[model samples]
Target: MTAEKEPHLSVARTATSPSAVQVVDLFCGVGGLTRGLEDSGINVVAGLDSDADCEYAYSVNNDARFVHANLLETSSDEIESMWSAGAVRVLVGCAPCQPYSKYSRGTSKEDPSAPVLRFAKYVDDLRPAVVSMENVPAVSRHPAFNGFLETLASAGYHISWETLPASGFGVPQTRKRLVLMASRLAPIALPASNVAKAKTVRQAIGRLVPISAGEANKVDPTHRASALSAVNLERIRNSRPGGTWRDWPDDLRAACHKGESGATFPAVYGRMEWDVPAPTVTTQFFGYGNGRFGHPVQDRAISLREGALLQTFPQDYKFEKAETLRSFALVGRHIGNAVPVALAKQIGNAINSHLEKYI
Candidate 1:
């Protein structure tokens, strides 16, 4: 779809003032990173993304200009124009990571280096004071990633990187991602995880108004649940929380499961446990067959809002307008792809703390 630009807020422009720590988020999908930075009291001047679908969410949720431009096409001059000349500049880039995701290992052979290379090019061109990027854990092992680090180090940036579990950062999901931070100002480090006891699935969505399979909560469209077939519902009814499809009776088992290869993939057709953090939320989290997305007690897969909440998005974070379609596939992808707001907030706080040392 052709990307449409969202309306601009005057306050978003004010962030470019000389005194604020101005940030320009690259590939800023739906403003999850921007919102987290804002929560940490940073001044984000703008966000840029090629996806037209992200415009409304980014603009509505954070005080940042949403530029509907692809990173590959946007020039250093164009990005520089968005910030003041004297402000402490930071660039946040979390490139799309499917190429490096664990699930993509065997089936997908895509290289997926374009976005990473584009981000590195932007850093080389802009030479922002601070740079932050997050991706799948596998990215840390890639040769290109090592090359990117070398480039940053050559530019005199004190870099720190680590792979952290989202549960450790208070996200009610077990997602793990590689995070890297580099700063020319001084040595900077990633924030230590805060979730002493990881938040549980029940804690994240216990109070939302319940919805049955295929039912939409009239009060909140995002709370709509995906429908289940009669047989699927019966399977879920028999399945135990945290148990795999192996819990199913022989009659309800998939034909594939009865086959020789079925034992290899056991996470599917499972229900989330109430007391533990959920499995990593994926692009198809609304489907029961996708990961362990079924609700602890509810007879349906978790709702769209539930999925968002699990990703640590604020309860009121806006994704689309009330009149929007709120399609399961679209919303599901948006929620799943987002970097957890809480984890991003920790990154922001770490950067802010590091900056404080120099300021």
Candidate 2:
């Protein structure tokens, strides 16, 4: 089915009921999380992020005020003011998870800047009616992560958390993320996976307005890729669906592939499969050497548009203007990292059902 026909898909913000609960999105890179929340009838009053590139897209797409401030630096008073202005204060945070990701396997925690732990401080201070956090699955096992849950418990929240597979909720990718929900109203469970069969790359991107190398889609310009060099062009052509660099001829393989470290990173320099859900779309999705980012049938790495679409972004979602490459990257990264709209909506639906008693 075309993305347009997908019932769960929504992009641009719509007018919500005045009774709609207001949300404050923390670390709201480009508002992907807010978009999902807004679609579920939440009014996103504001979005906060450190990256300036996120400002335009977050503001324009979701029509929420964008605050370019580091979560660590922003004072509790500032957060409280923002929350008080909203109808029903919902604090959502997606702290940086790279330091705790399984991908950073050999890295030591002794590294000076560990920001994930700081999220607990924000939770302690704001004390919103509800708190939701999403992050890499590996983080759930961390001591700091456990401590954060403890902090929430101390604040009188009945919490529910689980590691969820994105594909289980109809996302066209195989990614696992930890989702946590805390509330005083009662114990809140996240939505169950809605998908019975996994969606594939073909199902996600096959019908989008197509564009050539270095060309932008006229209808929605952000759906384009930077042009490929001659060598890279040939490399992508030889890469088969779901196949890695091992399929390449000796002459075509990068020198790194012949080395020991390279052998361990087989998923890099790979192509996506048409029949299976894509590998987790990451910030570097526009780069062919990053994960299985290449199109299964097309001879180009997935475009920014395809990446966003695979993440269930609405076709009409406004990214940064055409000239802002950095903004596009920020928007793409946020969309890639976002909880799938379908998944978020399911969570909202679950919350709605749970709230029926009070309503």
Q: Say which candidate scores most in TM-score.
A: 1
Output the lDDT of residue 78, model 1: 84
Off by over 4 Å in 2: 1-20, 84-86, 103-114, 323-332
Off by over 4 Å in 1: 1-19, 105-111
- For model 1, residues 1-359, the per-residue Cα lDDT tens digits are 11444454222244435556888898888877888888888888888888878887787777777888867777888888887767888999788787778754245454577788778888888889899998889988777788788889888889999999989988988889899999988889898988789999989999898789999877777888899999999989988899988988889999989888987878788899999899898878899987788998889898889999998899887777778756788888788888889998999999899888876
lDDT of 2 by residue, 190-300 (tens): 878878898888898888766766777776778787677887788888888878889888888888989998998887878888888988877778877777888777777
TM-score of each: 0.94, 0.87
Q: How close is candidate 1 to the true structure, as a TM-score?
A: 0.94
Candidate 2 accuracy as lDDT: 0.73
Q: Tell me model 1's lDDT, rounded to 2 decimals.
A: 0.84
